[model samples]
Target chain A: MKSVLCILFTFGLWLLLTWSLDPKVVGVGLMMAILVATLLAHIYPDNPHKALDPRRWFWACIYFPYFLVLCIKSNLDVAYRVLHPDLPIRPGIVKIRTRLTSEMAKTFLANSITLTPGTMTVDIVGQDLYIHWINVHGVDAEEHTRRIVRPFEGLLRRVFE
Target chain B: MSETIAQWIIGVGLMFDLLGCLGLVRLPDVYNRLQAGTKCVTLGTCMIMFGTFLYGVAALDRPQMAVQALLCAVFVLLTSPVAAHAIARGAYRAGARLWEGSVIDRLGEDLHGVRPPAERAEPADQPAAVHHFTESES
Candidate 1:
C-alpha cells in the first residue's frame, strides 16, 4: 500500500515537472516512479492511509493561506529589526514542549515555527523543541509553547495526526 | 494589465530579497542571520516565481512556463525551511556561540547541566563528540 502511494506521488511529481501528456514521457515516468517508490517505500509514515483522508486534505488547503499571512507578517517584522539602527533584538534559545507524537506532524510543526514570527527551530529533542527567538519575551516554557506552538498545533494535529 | 501586475509583484519580491541580504550583513550572529536570510529570501524568491507564473500565463500565454514557475515556487516553499533548520542545528552542534545579547541558551543548558547563566557568560565549547546524547538517546 505504501509502495502504491509512493508510486502515485512520484509519478504525479514527474508529470508536473515534465508537464507533458505524451505517451512515451508518461511510460518512462511510471517506470521510474515504480523503481524509486519500491526503493523508498519503507520511509513512508506508519499510517499511510491517513493521507487519503479528505478532512486532512481540506485542512492542508486551509493551512496554505493561513501560513502565507503569517509568513508575510514575519518578513515585515524581520525587516523592521534589520533596518532599525539599534537592531532591536533580544535573541535566545528557549525550549518548548509539543504534544505531537507523530514524526511527520512534528516536522511540519518545526517548519512552520521556523517561517513564522521571530522564532526558528534550532533542534528537536523528543517532545522538547529548542527554538531561537529573535525577541525573547518571557522566561516560562509553557508561555512560550502557548505563544509559539499552540497556534499551529491544533490545526496540524487535525491534518497529520 | 497583467504584465503590470506581474512586474509589481516581482518588484516587491526584489525588495524583499534586498532586505534579506541586508539582514545577512546586519544580523550579529549565525542563528540570527539564518533566521533573516532564510525567511526573507525564501518568501522573496517564491513571490518572484509566482509573478513569473502570472506573467507567463496571462501576459505571454505560455502555460508550460507558468506551470514550471508555479512548481518552482512550491518547491522553494517546501524545502527552504528544512534547509534552514539543518543549518541551525549543525551550527549549534558545532559550537557556534550565540551573540552576547542573547538572553537564554536552553540547548547549552541541557547539554552542560547548567541553568541559564549571566548575560556575558560563554558556554564551554566542547566538540560535537560530547553532544552525541541526542543521537544516542533517540
Candidate 2:
C-alpha cells in the first residue's frame, strides 16, 4: 500500500515536471515511476499502520512555517554581518549537547542550526554536536544549548520522537 | 506591478549573491567561508528561483515554468546544506586551520588528541548523565 502511494506520488511529480497531459508522456512516466518505486519500496517499508497519525502530520505542517521564519531571520542576520565594516564575527568551534535521542531529530536540529544565524554544525559525535559559531558568545555548554538547541528541540521531539 | 515585484525579488537575490561572494573573499578561514558561501548562496539562488516562479505565474501566466522554478528552489534548499556539511567535515579532517583568534577547538583536541573524561566533566547534578556517553577511549 505504501509502495503504491509512493509510485503515485512520484508519477505526479513526473507529470508536473513534464507539464503534460499527453497520454504517451504520462504512460512513459508511469512506467518509470513504477520501476523506481518497486526497486526502492523495501527500503522504506511502512510500520504496520502506525505511520498515519494525523497529529504528527499537523506538527510537520507547523514545523515548516516555523522553520521558514527561522531561515529568513538567519539570512538577514548573516547579511548584516557580511555588510558590516568591522566584520564583528568571532568564529570558533564549540561543543554543545542535545537531548534529542532519535537520529532523525538530531539531523533536523543540525541542519536547522547550519541554516540559522551565525552557527554551522560541523560534526556530531554521540550527543555532543560541534558547531562552528560565527560569533562565540560564551563557553558554557548549558547557555549555548539554551540559546541554540532548545528552541527547536521541543518541536522536533514532538514531531519525530 | 507584478513584473516590477518579480524584478525586485531577483534584484534582492543578486544582492545576496554578491554579498556572499564578498564574504567568500573577505572571511578569514575555511569554516567561516563555508558559513558565508553555503548560507548566502543557498538563500540567494533559492530567492532567484522563487522570483522566476512568481514571474512565470503572475506575469507570463505559465504554470509549467512556475512549477519548474519552484522545484529548482526546493531542490537547492534540500541539497545545499548537505554539501556544506561534507565540505566542512573534509576540511576539518584535512587539517584546515581555524582562524588564529578561535576560542575553542573541541573537535581538534578530541580527534587529534584525547581529553581524558575528567577534563570534560559534565554537570553531575543533571539527570541526563546516564544517556551521555563519556569520551570514547581513543
Candidate 3:
C-alpha cells in the first residue's frame, strides 16, 4: 500500500512536470516511477511500509510555514551582520543536546539549524551536537541550547518521531 | 507586471548571493566561511531558482520550465546541508584549526582517536611505537 502511494506520488510529479494529455507520456512515467519505486525505495532509511498519517502531515505543513518565516528573518539578519561595519559576529562551537532518537529526525534537525541563518551543526557525538554559531551571546551550553535547539524541537517531535 | 515581479525576485536573490560572497571573503576562518557559504548561498540559490520558476509559470506559461526550476530548487535544498556537513566533518578531521576566538572544541574531547595532526605528538608515558598514517590520518 505504501509503495503504491509512493509510486503514485512519483507518477503525479512526472505528470505535473510533463503537463501532457498524451497517454504515451503517462505510460512512460508509470513505467519509470515503478522502476524507481522498486529499486530505490528500500534504500531510504525510514520504513517504507509504515502508513503515513495525516497528523504528521499536518505538523509538517505547520513546520514549513514556520521554517519559511525563519528563513526570511535569518537571511535579513545575516545580511545586516554582513553589512555592519563591526561585522558583529562572535563565532564559536557550542554543544547541544536533543531528545530525537531516529537518524532521519537528527538529520532534519541538523539541516534545519544549518538553513536557519545564525547557526550550523558542525558535528554530532552521541546525543551532543556541536553547533557553529555566528553570534555567541553566552558561553553556557544550556542557555545556548535553549536559544538554538528548542524552537524546532516540538514541531519536529510531532512530525518525525 | 509578472516580468517585473520576476526581475525583482531575481534581484533579491542576486543581492543575497552577493552578500554571501562578501561573507565568504570577510569571515575569519574555514568554519566561519562555511557558515556563510552554506546558509546564504543555499537560500540565495533556492530563491533564484524559485524566481525562475515563478517567471516560467506566471510569465511564460511554461509548466515544464517551471518544473525544471522547481527540481533545481529541490536539488539544492536536499544537497546543500549534506555538503556542508561533509565539509565540516572533513575540516574537523583534517585538523583545520578553529578561529582564535572560538569558544570551544567539542570534537577534540569527543573523538579520542582522531586528534588534530599538530597535537599528535607521542605521549612520554607510552613507549614510542612506529605509527603508520591511516587514510584518515593522511
lDDT of each: 0.89, 0.81, 0.79
Clashing pairs in 1: none
Ranking by lDDT: 1, 2, 3
Summarize candidate 2's per-residue lDDT along B47-124 as a digit string, tens digits: 899999999999999999999999989889878887888899887876565766566777877786864445434434
Model 2 docking grade: medium
Q: For residues A1-161, write the lDDT of model 1, one tens digit per residue.
A: 78988999999999988989999999999999999988999987879778899999999999879999999999999999999987899999999999999999999999999999899999999999999999998779999899999989999999999
For candidate 1, the per-residue lDDT at A89 reads 91
Sort order, TM-score high to low: 1, 2, 3
DockQ per candidate, 2 decimals: 0.72, 0.52, 0.46
RMSD of each: 5.5, 8.8, 6.0
Compared with the true structure, what per-residue lDDT tens digits does model 1 show for residues B42-136?
Answer: 99999999999999999999998999899999889889999999999998877777776678888888976785566225335455443222112
Question: After superposing candidate 3, which stretches have Cα over 4 Å from the reference?
Answer: A1-42, A49-51, B112-138
Candidate 3: how large is its RMSD? 6.0
Extract clashing residue pairs from model 3.
Answer: none
TM-score of chain B of each: 0.86, 0.80, 0.79
Task: Say which prediction, candidate 1 or candidate 2, comes out ahead on DockQ.
Answer: 1
User: Which runs of model 1 end up more than 4 angstroms from their true locations?
Assistant: A21-28, B115-138
Best by DockQ: 1
